[model samples]
Target: NDFPLVLQVGEEVVSLGRIACPIILTTLLIHSRSIVSTLFLSHLGDVELAGGSLALGFYNITGVSVMKGLSAGMDPICGQAFGAKRWAVLSQTYQKMLCLLLLASTLLICLLWLNLEPIFLRHALGAGQPTRAQWTSVIGISLAFGYAILACVFTNFLGEAWGKLYTQDPDVVKLISIGLPIVGLCELGNAPQTAACGVLSGTARPKEGARINLFAFYLVGFPVAILLTFQLKMGYRGLWLGLFSAQVACVSMMLYTLLKTDWKHQAKRAEELTAAVGERDDLEDGLINDSNDER
Candidate 1:
């Protein structure tokens, strides 16, 4: 009841406000979905809900967070390099991120798959434990979903890709606009394919790809998915299915957006490339200088 709300208007403020709202809401929706799923299961029975939440949180904190952190470094690099169109740097970042995500995610998934029930479920149940059928189902569901969570880390790299693409060609934005609706067509089952497309696109395009993904995931993808999931009561399956809708929209948008991008032409122009590279280098140097001064 004591919650406070504030609204203000200014050019810079509005721009930031616009960006902030979607991100906050999207992330909130994700957490809400997780909590609600637990609540739904809880309605079925307390032990089921509590135990489920515990295992979910554990896997997320230990496995999910670690992978996200390890692979997320590409965000800054992609954001900056993409704007600069440093193809060499962008290429390097993509390879490194892919390699890192693969190694880190593999190990995390293995451990999670191995101990889905033992560490997450049984520990929650304590001495007596639930029926074999129940625990077995939990283990199966947990492990089945583990592969999906692994996708999030790779998805992080997409920010860099889309960011670079946006920097290279603004037209891609328009393309993504047209493409988004088609993805919407996939309707309920778009996340896995969409997410995979995003990560690959991000890793490939770095600049525009990452930026597009950030928009799609944080903005279009997530919000749309959240609405479908909550309003339609898609449940766990629905939630995952809804995820695809966002990805499809984003990927299609990016493709349409790419129709306008002429990075190859931009890259071939020596003077333009030099100036762009120099400008980018200056920014990096400035950051390093600032860091040095701070130290």
Candidate 2:
């Protein structure tokens, strides 16, 4: 028997909200570190604020993004394992992911310590349920809209004076006024793209998300940024426009992928992934027990 359409949707919203709310809060809390640091930096001086911002941006690209991306890969494996009641597989997968992240972090530490150039670059699940995917998209898009509105309101309220909050330098304030709004617009794309990524994670298809990101940023976004920044002489504004373009491309692709996703297929894949790991765990356990018996 099927439930009413409204009821089904209501339930989905409630369920997704339950999971999403805590995640939203946790994300805000995590990023609050950087926010707080920026606040402190702003009080130091213009040069200090600028330097701190650059450092934070670099750390985000190299350190935080790397760890977050790698750790996200485990979401599907762990979610599926738990869903299937494969506790051992879940535990093992979690442990392996932690080890992987630790190794990645160590490598990143070395790279950050040695590298000179300003360089670059940059979920989980209901395990492939389409209803969840759709609602998640809706929620993400909704949040993006909300953010855009808030950004606009804040930017207008602060006007060119917004920069004064961070620095006494008129030049710095001018730059902030121009850049801040564009950054806000970019979130129009960033928010939804992030939401779509969550859906992809839940469905055990992080590789696809990665591919989309690569194509969107490198193939589409970067080229556009270059053209606008250098070719058109848009300068910093152009650079931000490039980011906006990238975000738009990324979100479009993400939403399209989610729309076209075959959720049933993903569910089957999740089952298989969890089952294979479960079997391996069982095999390992059996072997260990046999060794103990022999001893």
Candidate 3:
């Protein structure tokens, strides 16, 4: 008998939530560390606060973001392996990921140590399934819109007073009030794109996600930011607006790709990826030969 559609969807939501909630909480907790640090820095004076904030941002962009992105590639492989009960594959993949991350960390450290000039600039899940792509897409789009609305609400609610939470300096508060809302709006694009990327990874198609990000951020977003910041004199606000533009492009392209996806083909690909070999092959051969002799 086929499972009821409503029940199936409900199950999917629960499953997704099971995986997502812990991650969300962990992310919030991790970020709170930075917030706590900033609060302490604020007590030390503006220059100290500014330098500390810059260092934290720099570390996030160069170190944490890179590691997270690299680690994400494992989602598909490991998820498929687990689903297919390929314990060896899952174990090996985990080990390899550790090695890769260690090497990457080493390289990043060297690069950062060698060059401090670029510090002035820049900034920066899984796929698998019981064919969870559709539900995942819905959740992603919902989050995109939800975050956008929240951004607007909070921005309005806080109004000019929002900046006072961090500092009493009128100039600093003014800068925060102007820039924070744009940064919040950026989540409208960032949220959905992040979810869509997970779907791609689940389907073992991380390269496409990578390409989309490169095109969105570097090819499109960075240029727009430079133009608005330097040419339009919008300053840091322009920089964030540029980020918003990139995020919009990213979510648009990500949704387009996900909408166009062939889920059945992805399932078949997952099966192929998890197919057994070696000892399993030999064991199956022996069983078939014995059955033939009995026949």
Candidate 4:
């Protein structure tokens, strides 16, 4: 196929002889991952297809796209490192990034498992269909984790007295008293970092979020945690300290990225994408006025 592939090289134009094959191949690979499942559902029935498609769309919008965007941040760093012949650093960066992505994927998968009922209810699955086992597991997991987080918040705000609600054992209560405040401090930093990452992903600048994570978690946070945990003998508190520091770093970096982003440019690009899709939809109702006026 004679697909026009133009490139500007030193004020001169050039064309790739056959670019369509590569472009088509790339498009197929990227889309087929999601589309294949929808195709499988299509064979089941119209309802199944519709529901599957809707759930897939929701996930693509809320999760996978954001993950991909954050991963893109590695592109620049990897490319520059390769070009500069810093092979060791490039390898290290790639390893760290892979580990981070795997960790995030694991955590998200666990969360998905724990929230199956709510997910089903929100999607095509009818309400009240969730089994007793599903409800039991969901409630159990939620309570187990929820109480800890809730206690952390209460303890942070109310101080040592809040620990008394959980246990009468002096030793356990003392541990809780120490852990709650640390967890709360970590959470305070974590909230903004998480929000900033979501915002960055939504704006199509995932690479910035990736850089923030790399520097915050691997570079600064890990070292501090090790130092405090081993050298200072701070134990679990040191781990929480590391988390707080990393979150603060991430928040600061994301805040700067937010301030520097060119909103006008992003808006223009979004409009262009909307127009492209609009042009492709022949049944678009809003375009009726234009057609009528023309007739």
Candidate number of the best TM-score: 3
Clashing pairs in 3: 127-202, 128-202
- Model 3, residue 93: displacement in angstroms? 1.2
Cα shift from native, residue 32, model 1 (Å): 3.3
Taken over the whole model, the C-alpha lDDT of each candidate is 0.45, 0.66, 0.67, 0.51
Each candidate structure's count of clashing pairs? 29, 1, 2, 1
Q: Against the correct fold, how does model 4 do in TM-score? A: 0.42
Alpha-carbon shift of residue 183 in model 1 (angstroms): 38
Write down the lDDT that model 1 would get.
0.45
- TM-scores of the models, in the order given: 0.34, 0.77, 0.78, 0.42
Number of the top-ranking candidate, with lDDT as the measure: 3
Give the per-residue lDDT digits (tens) of candidate 4, residues 27-78: 5886887767865775676578668879888877676765664465444334
lDDT of 1 by residue, 93-196 (tens): 56766777778778766331110001211111121222321232223333323434544444433443532332334454444443344334443223433333
What are the per-residue Cα lDDT tens digits for candidate 2 across 161-181?
A: 767766777877888888888
Sort the candidates on lDDT, descending order. Answer: 3, 2, 4, 1
Task: Using TM-score as the measure, name the better of candidate 3 and candidate 4.
Answer: 3
lDDT of 2: 0.66
Which scores better on lDDT, 3 or 4? 3
